[model samples]
Target: MKIRILTRIALLAAASAASFAHAAPAMVTEGILTGGNGMTLYTFDRDAAGSGKSACNDACAKNWPPLKARDDDIAGGDYSIVMRDDGSKQWAYKGKPLYFWVKDQQPGDKTGDGVNNAWHVVKP
Candidate 1:
């Protein structure tokens, strides 16, 4: 009976850890903001802060993909959710929509920063 109780406690701990992991959509890495996948995230200048909308859409989104948020994801503190033109949910930091550059091949790559003087890497 004691062994069974210990196993149940272990399972509960694992479940709690998984829930906490999904609480944050992104994390700071290498002095720059990155998605849960560790790819560098950026913001567009055209996007108005706290407007709750993303200016990058259609063809623009092809190059800079917005950091998508799950339907069940909750926003807190400096992080929030914005609705894309297609009605998709996106994660934002300090009201600025976060995105990933298509040219970025791996984690820590900020190649898309300063693209056309509009995009910039998100700095924590």
Candidate 2:
């Protein structure tokens, strides 16, 4: 019975580990931004900071999800929150909206940068 319980505990631990393996990101490195899962973060050229809005919507947004801002998040310095067309709040750096590319699978992947001459990595 003890061995059975031990095996169950081991299996549960392994499952937890697998689940948390990709539960990272939402982190910023130096001046560069990262996604909730460690993928590269980017911004769209069409997005206008002066307008305080995100232009990437509909099909574009499906591939690039905005970095969400929590209700308790407070804007400080270069970081701020902007309202999207869908009424969702997103994190912004220097007024530019932040997004995650669907194709970026790894932590440092920059595959989405310069795509179609619009997407670019968010720099410091």
Best by lDDT: 1
Q: What is the lDDT of every predicted structure here?
A: 0.91, 0.80
Q: Pick the candidate with the highest TM-score.
A: 1
User: Worst 10-residue stretch by lDDT in candidate 1?
Assistant: 15-24
Q: Give the clash count for model 1.
A: 0
Q: Candidate 2 lDDT (Cα, whole model)?
A: 0.80
Clashes of each: 0, 0
lDDT over C-alpha atoms for residue 107 of model 2: 86
The digit string of per-residue lDDT tens for model 1 on 55-98 reads: 99999999888899988777888999999999999999999999
TM-score of each: 0.82, 0.73
Off by over 4 Å in 1: 1-21
